[model samples]
Target: MAALEISKATRRIASTYPSLVLFQLARFFLVLATEMQAVAVGWQVYEITKRPLDLGLVGLAQFLPGIFLFLVSGHAADRYPRRTLLVLCYCGFTLCSGSLLFLTLRGLHSVYPIFAVTVLLGVVRSFNGPVSRAFLPQLVSGKDFQTAVAWYSIFIQSAVILGPSLGGLVYAAFRGPAAVYTLSFIAAALGAMSTVAIKAQSNPRLGEPMSWKTMLAGFHYIRSERLILGSISLDLFAVLLGGAVALLPVYAREILKTGPWGLGILRSAPAAGAATMAALIAHKPLGHRTGSTMLWCVAGFGAATIVFGLSRSLTISLIALLLVGATDMVSVIVRQLFIQVSTPDEMRGRVNAVDMIFVGASNELGQFESGLTAHWFGIVPAVVLGGLGTLAVTALWSWYFPELRKTEKLHSPAP
Candidate 1:
């Protein structure tokens, strides 16, 4: 009887939350396509200029649009039908991949055209990031939302794991990026289709008049909530300093004595670790001391970065990168849960928009920072110093953000 019941429960899971399945599918394909494009661009850019600063410029192009558009993007998410917005965003991504494929196929002499296309890609992502995050709360109810967050994280990490490796393999096998971009275009189109299939009940809109005040509400709310502010800011600074991913292309070419395929594997290492951790958290949520756990995990992330920077062996480097992703997942899960659970449904879009800036800065801007430092200080010192800086930031944030340090629960409303 127990065996029969277990089989019945497993079957029910397949039929449940069909919309959630589509949401995850959309998330997976879009991210997969993006990651594939990223690897190709990084290699292509470095190959053209043979300079680290240009790599930094690539990141800057992607990041600057978000800084300029965050206010408008957040507002659009709240005012527009989110499902429609997502479909449009995915379409934008498909178009971006098509643009890259055309550029690659035409034979590139300079990196300027690639940079121009990346800037266009960045503009689309600014809107997509906030709306995608804001859409999740509506798709899953309050009771299941935390698990949904974990599962969605798994979707993201799984793509990160596969995208670069597959991109790298395709690039090497075909002797260029044309095949990779072609695949990315197809995947992004599928992402659009998947998002179109989702029929989630949209979040209710307040129909508030547009104003600077309304647009900036997300900033004010985050500021007033110390826990939210501290957690988000903590990640912004920590990952900004600790992130060494921008240097992977260089490492694969010069330092590691490898090529594009090796770079792909290195790129996927962190995500591989993150997916494993997310799957565990989905099965069993962190039950206590969420804030403190985050603090410790970030510190671990810093230490891991330091190890990755100093290591010369490929095996050791992969392990260090794995630890980097694993430790960072704790912060990712905690910060996401805090923001989603604490904010009301109406305000989620805008707040997540503000949060996107913080997180995006940590990622794209962080890549730019890494590349700049590598240009100025040489690769090893840049990475090692950044890792050490992350440790110092963690120590100080723990001291300054008493509210964050004292917080014990992951799911509680922020008061």
Candidate 2:
């Protein structure tokens, strides 16, 4: 039944937009390698410093590049061939992965080298993220775009589910991260090739000269659109506080008394949950109460986070994290669909850049916030506090953006 459903979905996508298959392939390798590299990095970094702050620093290093280059990168996506830019970014990823391998081979006494390379990877992502997101809408027809986005997430979640497990297997077999890093490099290089194979034509423009007005267009547009503002900002704050991913290493090592293999399972649980949500969304499109659904889901995400924070048992923790991913997926799909449909193609690069920035800040910067709070307040307290913060943000956002709260249906993309 699962295979048949996927086959039907593939045929539908192929009939409307053939290139999306290749697009999904590119994303698969890219996400798989990235997640594997992440597991390696987390383990290696924690092994070196044994400090939660350094772990947070790792996230901050990657996030800062997106913060400083957000507008410029977005502009480049609009000004350059997005596909070409993406290819370059993948090459950069390959280099970064290789650098990690080199650093691992050399024997590390400090985490500075790890942090430095992560900054480089972050720079690549700053450009790649917005371009990749904006490029997705062009991969499918307008009517099927929402469904495509949901399925798109399925591919991502699939990688999320597998990457850590593979990373752990390799890491345990080798007793180090060097082999994992090598695999990451190989995957990234393949991602570049898959992208080069994409035959779809992207209409990136070079005619628009760089100006303050042109650069700021995405920011201006988002600010003026109240619904857009609410959706993005709500996600920004909700996940910003609700996220517990950065602290997984700490959980596995300290509280859970588990090693890298256990950490891998912990990391993958959320993705496993996300996969369930995406599959459901793909099979049955969201109902009329999408706006209310989104709000409720975010609230559920926070509640789940709290449960995970308070739990000492691995079984309960995994269940909590699963709920966390499931609830978060609902809001994310709704937000992505609404944002993509309402924004014009010409402005997609810029708009999605801003959106990507918010996302990065919520995840990476949120890591820094989590680490600092953990250092100050202790790990369990930090996580519990973040969950509470997410709940508070949800309440405030619901009241502040009734536009998002009362939303009836997602918008259809402009053809």
lDDT for 29 in candidate 1 is 97
lDDT of 1 at 181: 94
Give the TM-score (vs. native) of candidate 1: 0.88
Per-residue C-alpha lDDT of model 2 across residues 116-221, encoded as one tens digit per residue: 9999999999999889988888777767777888888999999878887898789989999999999999988888888888876555455578888998999999
**Candidate 1 lDDT, 73-176, residue by residue in tens:** 99888888889999999999999999999988788999999999899998999999999988887776665666678788988998887887789889989988
Model 2 clash pairs?
Answer: none
lDDT of model 1, residue 170: 93
Which ranges in model 1 have alpha carbons more than 4 Å from their true place?
1-14, 42-55, 102-113, 248-263, 368-382, 412-415
